[model samples]
Target: MAKRARPGMRRKAIVLRDIDPPGTLATNLFRAVYNPVVQAWASGAERIIAAYAATVSEMTTDAPADVRAEIDGAAEQINRLVLLLTPDLRRWALSVEGYVRGRWRGAVLSATGVDLQTVIGPEDARQTLANYVEWNANLVADVSAQAKQRIGNAVFSGLSQRKPAREVAKDIREAVSMSRARSVRIASHQLSSLSGELARERRREAGLEVFAWHHSRKAHPRQDHVVRDGKLYTENPALVGKKVDGIEVRAAPPADDRAGVKPFCGCRERAVMVFEFDD
Candidate 1:
């Protein structure tokens, strides 16, 4: 005979299953920013690569000075390209911040049915937006600097090897291609992390009692052990004197490693709402 399930257990299962997971806002924003930056970088890199390839044969040990100058010039051009793109990158950061902020506000409302504007003042929202914008801007600048360094190193190594001009040019092109792929991965991971952090912060401000970790289901094996599906945690454990406004929430023990906080993590957090009065 089939056994009947307990009413309380059934309701708990439904609530867990009904919780909304994090969206793809971060990935989308990463792609939006990465595409244009890569396109522009490719265009500039081609010009630099071509110029080097044309003059590579002139870089013999006897005429090393001219070759060195050419390499330096290429590096200078890469830096200049990054500088030229800064303003546009900053603009994109601001746009992404605004979009993420809106999503944060909406997520809080959906979870607790309380508008963030009513709980947290407008000034706090603006400050949060500003923080996200600054974070993205810094990420862009860091990626750009890393790219320039990689290109410079490739050029130096190729020229130093006294290889044929065409071969050296090929090396530089390959380096740039690898760097482009890496930068996209890095940017995507960082953006997702930022999104998760913002969501957690807004939920806390909205007075949500507990937050659950939501895995992407597509996460690698290493991340699977960090937090099981539907696991929850308290926002502050040290505040013993603080008044508790909601039911005590608990979950599996915290992981020893910071898997979800690292780069390339796809995990997100969901606010676990506990209502004082039944709806």
Candidate 2:
């Protein structure tokens, strides 16, 4: 038998749709910067990669220094790319915040007969979230930086082995592709994690003690989280060990294993307003 959602429980999906657009835009922005830059490295006679390859063909030791300089330049370019994406990422996070605030306010009022005051109010949380957006945006930048390093190493190693410019270009393209994929993952994870964290704080502030485990009904859901769906748990027990389903005590979920948190499971919490209102 299915347990119907109790009062104050909002399906996390209502806000899940808000997670993807900015991530998509971030990916597109990254690709715009990543693809052309990498392509320029290996193209025409004057191309950076072509020039480096030519030096190696001529058996010149000076090629290493020149290529190193180019590598450093590429790294700086990757750093600057973060500036372009940060604004959009911050806006996306704030949009998620707006939706979560709306969802939480409506749910709490409907269930508790009291309008809950936000403990994690925007005044306190805004700067923190902005910093979070900056941090996550840097994550995308880091991927590109790492990709640049790989391209440098691959080009030098390949040329020394007498590999063609086209071969080195292949490796460079693969690195760019990998970096783009990682940027997408970082964006998606940041949005979902931010949403869940903000919601968790709101629940705590409202004095909600128990919450239903809501499995993300996305394709290929994790089985453990799926099993937890509709069950109740409390993070109120010192924010560490928790009471699961009101039947057994369990440790707080490990940081990496946090249900519906980022970089892993997407499961979310549906706070249950079990408080008695003094009318």
Candidate 3:
């Protein structure tokens, strides 16, 4: 933590090369969001299976009509499942966005020894946060769409194959699990991306044009991102190869050009404010 600053005075910047991400918070949010959704999905899967089994005793081998109608209804259950969970997602999005913003502010304060709230007023903060609203919406939409598609595919493919009720139920269970895992990944990635964006905007406003690159150091990190660790970057990357303080942009450029960083990249821009002349 940075020391308390007196009114009308600024504290010296901390010599920190790596200001870590809000990993704990991110993980907690993932569980908070994933667990309930998975449970609900599990229940929905059960309902789907139940639909197919309602007339199980009447079913005979190659009863194609029963499989088609019953399993189609099963697919519809997934649609309802998405609708059932969407309201909760809206609430989750709002809360997670606020939490990520708070974490980003804390990271800035710790790295630069400046109070972000003091520098970034309430209106500016709200406006900056508001600009990223679409990201949250994307979370909701993508989850819903993917869930429906994956489960629908499982149901339809099983129907086409004329698989037994038990086998179809198995397929649905696997699909629900797959959907949950994919949703978790999307949630975690978006949080990382959002925090990275917040860091860039807030740091630049605080006269922090240069930043120390922080590699997440997670398992199986990208080769390029690993090489970027502990280096410095400017907003302008037109000169990627130019060395400043021995920064060599030999690593491959990010695939996404929108933010000068790629989604799920896990790297962060820690504000590096130079406070005094070198001896």
RMSD of each: 7.4, 6.5, 5.5
How far in Å is the alpha carbon of 209 misplaced in model 2?
1.4
Where is model 2 poorest over a 10-residue stretch in terms of lDDT?
12-21
User: Candidate order by TM-score, highest to lowest?
Assistant: 2, 3, 1
Report the error of model 1 at residue 3, Å: 36
Off by over 4 Å in 2: 1-47, 83-89, 109-121, 127-131, 238-252, 275-279
Candidate ranking (lDDT, best to worst):
2, 3, 1
Model 3 error, position 232 (Å): 1.2
TM-score, one value per model: 0.68, 0.72, 0.69
Can you write out model 3's per-residue Cα lDDT over 1-279, one digit (the tens) per residue?
222432343433343344344555456545655555556667766766665564354456554455456545644554555455544544544554556456656766665455555544434445445544545445644665565566657655765565677887887788778867776776677667665665565566656555666777789878777867777566655534555444443333353722324656677767665442222
Q: Record all residue pairs in model 3 with backbone atoms less than 3 Å apart, i.e. clashing.
A: none
- In model 1, where do residues sit more than 4 Å from their true spots? 1-41, 60-63, 77-132, 219-221, 224-226, 238-260, 276-279
| Candidate topping lDDT | 2
Candidate 1: Cα lDDT at 186 = 64
lDDT of 2 by residue, 14-77 (tens): 1111222234543444454334433433332134566566766776778767766776776676
